[model samples]
Target: GAGVSQSPSNKVTEKGKDVELRCDPISGHTALYWYRQSLGQGLEFLIYFQGNSAPDKSGLPSDRFSAERTGGSVSTLTIQRTQQEDSAVYLCASSLARSGETQYFGPGTRLLVL
Candidate 1:
């Protein structure tokens, strides 16, 4: 893909259900990130993977929120036991190298938990 892309542009799930959000980053990007944007709020960092290093998951809000990047390209974010508070736009971004580099964003996945 020319840029990052995410699956299921919109998702609606009931409380306590689980959902998986996928992200396909640019071919050569070495850093991938996941973020959450609540209504009317700024982007909140969720997790990020850099090269072969351990992913920085310090930003994930809870154990229910987890993500993984495989083969250094595609990533998946899984939210378990979804809650209404978790309803938001889940965004994915990729950068050429480290965390501070400029990132290319994908169309976000809007998750609505009812």
Candidate 2:
């Protein structure tokens, strides 16, 4: 892809449902990441994957949140049994390197749990 792309820019779901958000990162990038931005909140790191390195999943809020990157390109974030507090923008970013370089962000998947 030319840039980071995320699907279902807006999602509305009832509590306790499951949702899957997708992300397509820029071509040739080696680092991919997922973050959450709640209303009036700062960007919170969720996970990060670098080429052949162990994925960093320390920021996931709970076990209900999970993600994976296949072939170092596309990635998916799955949220299970969602709750009202889960309503927020799920953003995906990618960088050319894994040393905290500047990250390009996707439009984001907006999840609304009511």
Candidate 3:
């Protein structure tokens, strides 16, 4: 991977539908993070994966939202039973360091839960 990027840049789905978002991080980046931006809601951390260590999933809004990073490369965010409130932009970033480093962000996946 060269730059951080997300798939399905825009998506529209009916309520209760399930959507899967994908993110590809930069090569050689050792840390990755996911974030969500919504109307009225600033920025919220969703999760983080550092190297081969266990991912920090505490930021996930609920059980309906889940993610996974494979082989320290690409990562996917799955949102089950999408709702109108779930309409937002999902962003992914990768850094060369675990913390306090420049993290390149993806363009983001715009998901619209109608």
Return the clash pairs for model 2, or none. Answer: none
- What's the TM-score of each model vs. the native? 0.94, 0.94, 0.95
lDDT, each prediction: 0.93, 0.93, 0.92
| lDDT per residue as tens, model 2, 53-99 | 89999999999999988888999999999999999999999999946
How many clashes in candidate 1? Answer: 0
Error of 1 at 35 (Å): 0.8
For all candidates, the clash counts are 0, 0, 0
Model 3 spans > 4 angstroms off: none
The TM-score that candidate 3 achieves is 0.95
Q: For candidate 3, write residues 3-103 as lDDT tens digits.
A: 99899999999999999999999988989999999987878999999987889999999999999998889999999999898999999999996459998
Off-target runs (Cα >4 Å) in candidate 1 are none
Q: For candidate 1, what is the TM-score?
A: 0.94
